[model samples]
Target chain A: MDRMLSADEIVRGLLAKEFSAAEVFRSSLERVRRMDPALSAMLSVTEEAGMAAARAVDECVARGEDPGPLAGVPVVLKDNMCYRAAPTTCGSRMLERWTPPYDAAVVTALEGAGAVILGKTNMDEFAMGGSTEYSAFGPASNPWDPDRVPGGSSGGSAVAVAAGYVPVALGSDTGGSIRQPASYCGVYGMKPTYGLVSRRGLVAFASSLDQIGPFARTAADLARMLSVIAAPDPGDGTSSRRARPEYGAAVASASLKGRKIAVVRELAGMKASLSPDVEGTLARVLDLCRREGAEIVEVSLPRSLEFGLPCYYILAPAEASSNLARFDGVRYGFSRKERTLKALYERTRGEGFGPEVKRRILTGTYVLSSGYYDAYYLTAQKVRQLMKEEFRKAFASCDLIALPTAPTPAFRKGELVDDPIQMYLADIFTLPVNLAGLPALSLNGGFTADARPLPVGVQLIAPQWGEEGLLSAAAVLERHLGPASVAPMAAVKGGDGR
Target chain B: MTVSERDVRHVAELARLHVEDDEIVGLVGHFTGIMAHFNALARAGEEGRLPLDDLSPVVFAHDEIPPLRADEVVESSVGRAVLDAAPDAREGFFVVPRIMEGDE
Candidate 1:
């Protein structure tokens, strides 16, 4: 019943009869009841559903059949991911009451693996913003400091794991959604290579850039989750049909003995605006890589510096504008009364969508509109190609490119809530990878001097369909740097009565 | 850096969003600020490049198919939760206001 157990440890414990699934479930539920109110990490806790699933897992264990790899392990899913019985709101009022008739492909895989579904975590509205401040429900607080924000749109998933609410959770990364939050919250997050995981039931933000990933306390746990979910789904047209790798076994074999790691020169000093604490932590990570026999090379991605963000904004929104058009009050989601069909479309969308969602939709509409299509949307696509080409060149020289996940540590809630541009700039270092559809991971590099737990995440980027190389590099770094020590907030708050 | 009210209205219409007159001014200011930062993408100098579509996996042509399943089964799994949010629904189907006179 100890909180902060890795998902692998929890599964092993349950299998060995160390604790019943019901006992583990109860402990997680208790943790949520005590901690979630302050953290605001979860949008909805599936108490009844979770207990039911746990009981089923216990029964399977008693029957002497292998349940699954992650059997009996509690995990939180980002609210944007569709779950059969849970309301997948995407942290927006637009789909506040929308419930999918079926589970997302990842959910099916996780459930099939016998993982206990704890709840749906909160996120930015439609996973658009870097911070969860854009979430209609409200921002999730970083576990390290209550006043600071947990970097998001995967903030809730990251916080849930960082706070020990769950050992692992599913999060979707379009533009640094998974990695930024992982860095800010001081945990490991991986955005698998695009097409590696199915996006069938995910509420699409940017179809091309979006990929479901996992947040975990350690690399091994992340590998275990990846192995279960990283498989092609026929339902997802964009999903990869490539052979799946044994991620868990690969993690054990990950070694940097002769690995060529590249540090993108453009991104190295781009975080000049970051606090010195974060800068120093990143420096130490580089030092650790050198000590591990990793040959660090400085590679320049000139096109990436200029084109990545622009291409992302244009392409992502254009796709989003189309994907979101489905929620016009006819098929599903919030509706509004109006006399005319046009009025219904307007009123329903206006009433349902939040300010940020509306803004992006408008931007998207403008870019994709007939007159501006060539000038904005088409031009951005071309830029996206150049960005991808630049990445191709960089990969030829090195196995991975290291960079900071976010420009700074977690800022306080409401700090950039009023200013959308300031919030967007937070993903300066992490967006390009998504734009190029590359595999990237963020691990705990080091902490700041203030003891606020500034997580300096080194992003290891590999070519598309190169998840094996990406996870392997991350595993080496995780072992070399050592596991991050995070004190449970429950003990700090005196709530555990320890 | 000033986003005119007319620009805001035009964009709102294009986006299919209905904004109140009072909210327009505030929204214009927010848009202006966001656009200012978005302009950074322009300076990033990535013009004349190809769009993401060029890199897309090839879509094979499909052969002719037989008659599809009846609509009834397709509509069965859609639950009350999805239907309840619809603006108009009757007899387990989404109902819409008349788009044209004499239209069924």
Candidate 2:
């Protein structure tokens, strides 16, 4: 039920008339049907919409017209991204019944570029948790091993790419939602600089930090996806108007000559234990960079790593408290009727939101409340400024910063769900990148020595608006290691339809 | 616990979420555990790991703001589209529980 082809190869075949768009999409669609029962990567499949889109691409090709750059590629959207007519529940009971009236800017751009929309994938409800285990739909399993989790809130998107169900999927990273999952699932995930990609219709978790980016098997495919969606939109006031870069051009030959890559001296002392395999993978990547003529420097980011998790927990939830105030049940999503308006809100929110989301919202309310605001919220905001300045100083000496995407590889599904602090601690490396509004990419680092191949990802963070450089460096690594391969899902793929 | 069960109830009330009696115990433990992490940030400041004397809070980075357009009126069908999803709407207004007290 599986067909092996790179996303780039699929586009090449379509353009060269070697195959129809329908043929390529059918392979993925059939694979999803056969394998999704075990993986639960997607929430809904837009089969009819996909067929119509595939046929349009065929028509464009037959009529001697140029299909846009992403022509005929099947991609998944994280459930929070709006697609008109599809139920964008954000894997929350709150939005379970609501269909967005319009498409997200990224969705419109994907459709405009002739990319086939596969379906929406599961996520932590309202993008609130690190594990997709918080998803109301059910957790998305790691394709590498079903008993383990695909690290999330964009876990399903990462799994969709890792399992070869689709070539590319879009994920939003607010404190490493995209990159951590990508690292765990062993695929390429990018959290573009804040304001680089339009977040017009993405359900806002933390308005300031949330950024939509791509997940792919190859650096080239990621570049292709980035090129299409990372354009300014009038709808998103924060979307940058900076001149666009040719992201694909940098991927072919990324010479790291004379590049000073900083390995954070501070994270070396982080209390969380790194698995042996991940430590080896990080060392391998640094060695490759050294061989490629890049100078590795040890840089200090005092107070940044130590305080980032707490600061993020403070700020993301604070913004989420205000932003999520819109979902009062009267406007669109699930609501209840009561004698008074307050009771309606109380019951609806109580019934609809999952535990993690409740914790965040409650914690957010606590921090932003009267006297405690100064201690928690005010202090976090000031520290956030210090963190930004810290990154600026670090970047003054290094072209890019490198770290492990997460402390460990994909873990067992139920392991950290009940342990909120432990779950938040796992996001240590990825959070500071978002806090500084810099661009970071997670690509295949290496694998564990176990019988099953567990993928580890190395992250390279570039200064704000430095995605091109990040991609170039990742391209160099990709060339050395080869692209991260598809997760071997033979057991699940060939399992009896249960 | 830094935040007690009573505090959890007050905060939940502020956030407009109705917590059942059974959830209070778990919520208290969760908040205390997370608050311990938040305290680390406080200690970082108090211990001078980094100076936090009077640095102005940065809501967003200064250089990253997008250019704003003139506030000219633009027509859109968004009003109709937005109203389409309301739980109950009549003549473009959302119908909700009665606002005035004693109206029930």
Candidate 3:
């Protein structure tokens, strides 16, 4: 009944008959009820459905059948992911009451692996912003400091794992949504290689950049979730058909010895931009790598470091504008009454979308418009091509690349919410990987020296389809840095709910 | 790098999202600031700073094109579910505003 036990540990305990899956699920549900009031992490909690799933696992165990790899572990999904049992709000009022008739591919995979569906977690509206403050329902608080913001658009999913409501949760990262929040909330999160996991039912943000990943407190739990969800789905044409190795087994035997980890020389020039805690954490992580016999080398990524942010802002919004056009108040989401179709479309969108969403859509329309297409959108794409080539060359000299997940740790809520450009700068470190479609992990490198000790994440980037190596290195770091810890506030705040 | 209110309104119209007259000035400022950041890419391209030769836009994650599945129709019971989710539907069809005034 320990809420803090990892998904792998819970599976082992269930197998050993130490506790029924039903007991473990109820404990997690109870924890969510207790902790989520202050965290504001969950948009909705599916008690009946989750309990039914748990009992099904117990029945399998009673009948002498294997209950599957995840076996009775409770987990949550970012609301951007569709689930038939709960409404997929995507943290936007536009789709506030809309229920998807199908489950996301990851949802189906998790359920098939016997992971209980705890319900949908909150996110930035349509996953547009770096802070969850853009969520129409209100921002999810960072568990480390209630006054601070959890780095987002997957803020709620990160908080769920950090507060120990669940061992793992699925989050989709377009531009560091998963990894940045994982860093702020002090947990391990991975954005798998693009196309490795199916995007069958994930609400599209930026099609080429969006990827589904996991947040967990331990490397093994992250690996277990990845192994369960990473597979070829015929339903998703973009899903990779490349053979995937068993990630759980890969991490179990992982070693850091003889691996060459690269430190970007371009990042050194921007040292002034990094907060002291993040800079110190990155240095300490390199030191840990050296001590473990992994060689740390320097690589230059001039184009990527210089132009990644602008390139991503242009390209992601362009795709998002096209993807979100389907929500024009006619089919399944919010709609308005109008005499003319055009007026209905305009009124519905203008009223339904929040400020950030409208801003991006407008920006997207401008960039792709008649006068500016070549100068902005096409130029950004060419820059992206150069960035990809730069990464390809860097990977030739090194096994993996290292960087800070964000420029700083968690900032106070409302600090950057008003400044769109400043808020976009927060993702400077994490954008290049997504542009190149590479896999990356954010591990809690260390905490800031503040009274509350906000977490700073050290990011490790792997080459395409290099999750095996990425998870292995993360496992080694977990041993040296100590595993991710739940925020202390999860136990103290929100007690009024209980 | 300056976005006039006219340009903001034009873009909003193209995007099919109505913008209030009050919000146009703020949106113009947002666009100006965003465009200022994007100028770095344009300058880099114009100056030939990064090697932009013979490179194509990466539309897919991988270099190889994704394999296509067999294009065949399959029966599904999702018709009822789809209808149930629609804001306005009748007799298995979506309801919409009148497209033609005199034809009906």
Candidate 4:
């Protein structure tokens, strides 16, 4: 079995009687067992449950019943996304043993489509940090190089797809968690417009900015998974009531013959100190788009230059502070016995959360506290609104905005762990899209000469509710980029073919 | 301005987190640097605007639920597992320290 096969390939193969769903699943399980030890991508493996589900799919196919769109396809859920049988730890020891009584809305959707649940992938604790280094379980290593960090919070999901462990996996993007890892892992990851996917069972990081998206090797597979998962949910109030479009069909027919693409002029030169490899790859992607008949325009988004991160720091943590307060050891998650109620709450939280999560919670609480609300949280909200308006104007002039996903490629592990500011700055190019609740995608553009596969992703931001257009453009770009080889970790480990 | 250790401790208490005394110094330095980033927002005028306080409502409005028939509501067998994992529990209720005198 090849390390990477698209979801469509797996489904078609299962239907054609070439192999049973159990066989495909065994291969995936074997791959994860071999690769994940080195990659540290998965937090928990649902081997027994996954095999049972795969057998059920095979039985359905045997009876001549259709097993939905993604029938027999195995996918991993980010640990933050709740699954019935899997522990949704959210990469923190606070809820290390917490299991959801019910499946998250996305899990239900994927299950309904006959997708097999592989297991839970790792992430940063409470999705707070940019690198998976903040995970209490331990950092998820980049598939390209074991020594480097996987761009995070959704790093495991990205690495799972990159290493060919799973063709597609679910990831939640709050301030570029999905896109950054996708860029780092050299795969396609999309952060759909906020509220496009339901957030009912997701452990909330930042309620307003968080959205469930998927990572895959191809645009078509991402689109297919998106179509299955993106729909309004009665359980979530913020979920969009808009009708889900045929994303896969849209991708199949996407053409860039007359499309107008814009490169954010301000963001282009903003990271002037980027490594020569990354800069060269980005330039080549621009040239490829121009060659493919896209009319490129230069535009300015000055408001996003400084205000995005500050606004995010205030808004996300403030929301997170409130959302995470429910885990005080009373109703669910970690707890400690104490003589006083206040002490119980304090000790439970202190013992539960990791260092990064605690830092953000404290920052959030401080900003939202009485004396600082007006000076910090309130002002940040206003600036967020301004940034949204600026994006609205920028989109009017161009069909999509393009920029590098990260200022630099994946850095060595522990490189930015000490310097919190440097780590936060890594999301500079990708956060503005989330702040505006716009749909954006990261695709493998080009690579560095070191054969290290420096992934340069051009982000395409569309107006809210314009995921169809954004995806169509991404499909065109993916096709033009050609099929890039994924360097699977299993192969690097010198594992013999199973 | 340098954030004092007192401020860090105060923030940690408000956040409902316990921090060691030695860690307070590092946290103070981190918060001081983070607050400097907030300085940019000071220039933006936000006098009368409300913060995102209304983002989370105490209760969601919904249609009245019909009474469940005994057969319609299946009690989960996993309830035992859940309670078993609880750090503090007594009988069916999650055990908590006595809030009122003589409650225990």
Going through the candidates in order, what fraction of the true interface contacts does each contain? 0.47, 0.74, 0.78, 0.42
Strongest candidate by TM-score: 3
lDDT agreement with native, every candidate: 0.79, 0.89, 0.90, 0.82
- Share of real contacts kept by model 4? 0.42
Q: For candidate 2, what is the lDDT?
A: 0.89
Q: What tens digits encode model 4's per-residue C-alpha lDDT throughout B11-84?
A: 88898899977777778878888888886565544432333334332111111222323455555566876676
CA RMSD of each candidate after superposition: 4.2, 1.8, 1.8, 4.6
lDDT of 4 by residue, A1-498 (tens): 764678988999889988888988899999889888888999999998899989999999999999888988999999999887978999989889888877899999998999999999989998988879999999998877777787998999988888888899999999999999998888888999887889988989888789889998888888899999998776787776667887888788887777778887775566665677666777777777788788898778887767788888888889899999988888788888788888899999988888888888999998999888987887776677667767889888888788888888888899999778789988887888888888888888776665455566656677777777767877777777764347655434643332
lDDT per residue for candidate 3 within A1-498, as digits (tens), equals: 553899989999999899998898889888888778888999999989999999999999989899999999999999999998999999998999999998889999999999999989989999999879999999999888888888899999999999889999999999999999999999999999999999999999999999999999999999999999999988888888888888988788988899999999988789889898999999999999899889999999987888899999999999888998999888868998888889889999999999999999998888899978988898988888888888999999999999999999999998999888899999988899999999999999998888778889999999999998889999888888888998775333633323
Best by lDDT: 3
What residue pairs clash in candidate 3, if any at all? none
Question: Mind giving the per-residue lDDT tens digits that candidate 1 earns over A321-341?
Answer: 888888787877788877777
lDDT of 4 at B47: 35
In angstroms, give how far residue A391 of model 1 lies from its true place. Answer: 0.6
The TM-score ranking, best first, is 3, 2, 4, 1
Q: Model 4: clashing residue pairs? A: none
Residue B85 local lDDT, model 4: 64
CA deviation > 4 Å runs, candidate 1? A268-271, A490-498, B1-3, B34-87, B101-104
TM-score of candidate 3 on Cα atoms, chains taken together:
0.98
TM-score of 2: 0.97
Worst 10 contiguous positions by lDDT, candidate 1 chain A: A489-498
Where model 4 places Cα greater than 4 Å from the true spot, the runs are A490-498, B44-85, B102-104
